[model samples]
Target: MGELVERVDERDRVLGVVDRAEAERRRWMHRIATTICRDPIGRILVLRRAEQHARFPGHYDVMVGGAVNVGESYEDAAARELAEELGADVPVRFMFKFLCLDGVGPVWFGVHEAVISQPLVPDASEIAWNAWLTELELREVVDRWPFVPGGREALRRYLVSGNEPARPRSAERSPRPAAMPPG
Candidate 1:
């Protein structure tokens, strides 16, 4: 997670800018992150971030997520994160990318998803708790808790787009956009 940050536009698309200059010049250089959503008992898997994390500690996140490396693709990062954080081995499908232009701080939240193939055993070091949330329950949680701050917006966009996760595929590459570079 060395510096080499990324820059993006309002759509979270790469803006071909460097993170160091963005910060030194007071510009937004997005930090690439891979977000994963899962079907936990036919509901979305929700995880509470560990209190030890540097940002948004102890808050609720949709599922597995982490920063992207300087040269890694978002899909690979998401897939690795799923296994590293939850001991999951299912295929990771691509979702949409989220740009927090409002933060004036560049932190590109690259999103992905994978269906649950087996029971998840989330790593206690990275996550604190887990829950399965129906759409209604998700709405309530989004409305009530500050899940990712603009998480409600992200969820809404994801729901409206109807982007479904791809089943396990060992060879086929997902059409999902790649943002972060895998380590």
Candidate 2:
């Protein structure tokens, strides 16, 4: 038995509990809670998945999150994932929820955001590289990087919502390594 997740319908109504792997294998809808972390100065945190990650290996992601466990609210799952992945325990503001029908599978993605004030302790098993980038820098990277499909969609919707904070003129752009092809 692996991690258990609630199998849901298109309307996000819980049908029953299933192991996370079973849900994925059966193409059942499940909930994934994701959080976009930004610095106090508004730089978004981006991460490259480690090569050994079960899904989207060697891909880039703008959010850190995972499958929501059975009986967990989206908000609680978002906070838990942020802490598990980045070692940050900040308050997360729920942004929105949408059905993501990407190659990863159909999932109700609950998007959240937090301003992280503490240093990150990324789990090496999950994250190969991480950096804080201005929105402009992130945009450039997205154009060339093979990002995780669902996260890419989430970012697209988030950007369209115009909820992102304004970037200061003095915010420096960090140089990113060349993008690697997704494995």
Candidate 3:
């Protein structure tokens, strides 16, 4: 699920879409679009990849996500991911945008807030584990868990704004509990 596809932004101007492969391969300007999804208790959504995943296998990831499909709008992709990964149809609210050079490529991610947080049904082949955490706790875990390198800052801006993101905190749930496991 290397859905790190992004737009070729010429400083915030829509140039064109580039495939994740080309962007990563050529170090082109690109961004991994994602959504800051929340749970019923105001907890943010997190996901874990199955052991069989080719990349970042067995790592914990938080975000209702996927690649921005060709010809798809960011909001549409976010809404689609909410339903596909969380098993809920969420109406996306446009928030902010994060600009970061993911090292491999530049990401202009469109941050959006879902209207509601609902139970998830992650794609078995993609999500290994999933959970919800307070914004404070999200920062703490980023320090302890193997999160995507650029996720912390983006998560911070998207969730708590300028406030430091929660990291290196204990998890309220086990890595894989009775909850649904990433297939």
Candidate 4:
């Protein structure tokens, strides 16, 4: 079955729903949700997208997430994505949402964070590999490893918040106005 995606306007108001292919073909804005998972010791979880996947195949991503289906809330999507990709159902707290420019159109990206207490079992179909890295470790290899642009931006935002797993209320409620370069 084709995926039904929630379509939105420039300001992120819902316009209607469309199939994923049509949404991509028309460059329609749509919703996506991601979660930055951290181990109890504070190491962040990172994963590489499967090489066989479409869109930045084989690239590293800092979070586990995917497109929000029609009628699904971002928070629900975040949890669903975490479970689907990593087989971990950690309690994720919503961080923020921003309009990110992508190859097709602007994506209403909702980010969340959680400290995981259980071991993650990666789904091989979606993830090629996974790792838990400290802030310094991530910094050391980030420049050399190719990361998905939007995930990189989200990681940067996480770091800017003083390495906090969750975003501050002020920043989460109000993201910057400009379109973030997917770097």
Cα lDDT listed for each candidate: 0.63, 0.87, 0.63, 0.80
Best by the lDDT measure: 2
Quote the lDDT for 90 in model 4: 73
Worst 10 residues of 1 by lDDT: 174-183
lDDT of 4 at 99: 79
Please write out the lDDT profile of model 4 over residues 1-183, one tens digit for every residue.
Answer: 499998999988999888987887788899999999888766678788898977788898887899998899999999999999889877889987877785444788899998898877898889988777666667666666888888888888778866575322342222221212233
Better by lDDT, candidate 2 or 1: 2
C-alpha positional error of residue 132 in candidate 4 after TM-score superposition, expressed in Å: 0.4
Score residue 111 of candidate 2 by CA lDDT.
97
What's the best-to-worst order under TM-score?
2, 4, 3, 1
List residue ranges in candidate 2 displaced over 4 A: 170-183
> Top model by TM-score, which number?
2
TM-scores for all candidates: the values are 0.72, 0.92, 0.74, 0.85
lDDT of 3 by residue, 1-183 (tens): 454454566575556666677666776766445677765555677677678875567777665565667667778888887777667786887677767665344666666777464446777877767766665656567767777655656676665564223332454533433243334
Clashes of each: 6, 0, 20, 0
Compare candidates 2 and 3 on TM-score and give the better one: 2
Q: Write the per-residue lDDT of candidate 2 for residues 75-134, one digit (tens) a residue.
A: 999999998888898999999999998966898999999999799999999998888778
Tens-digit lDDT string for candidate 1 (1-183): 245655556665666646444453575655555555656434567777788966577777675766565567878778888889988888876777766544334456677767785888889888887766555556566655657654555677777887533333433222331221111
Question: The CA-based lDDT of model 4 is what?
Answer: 0.80
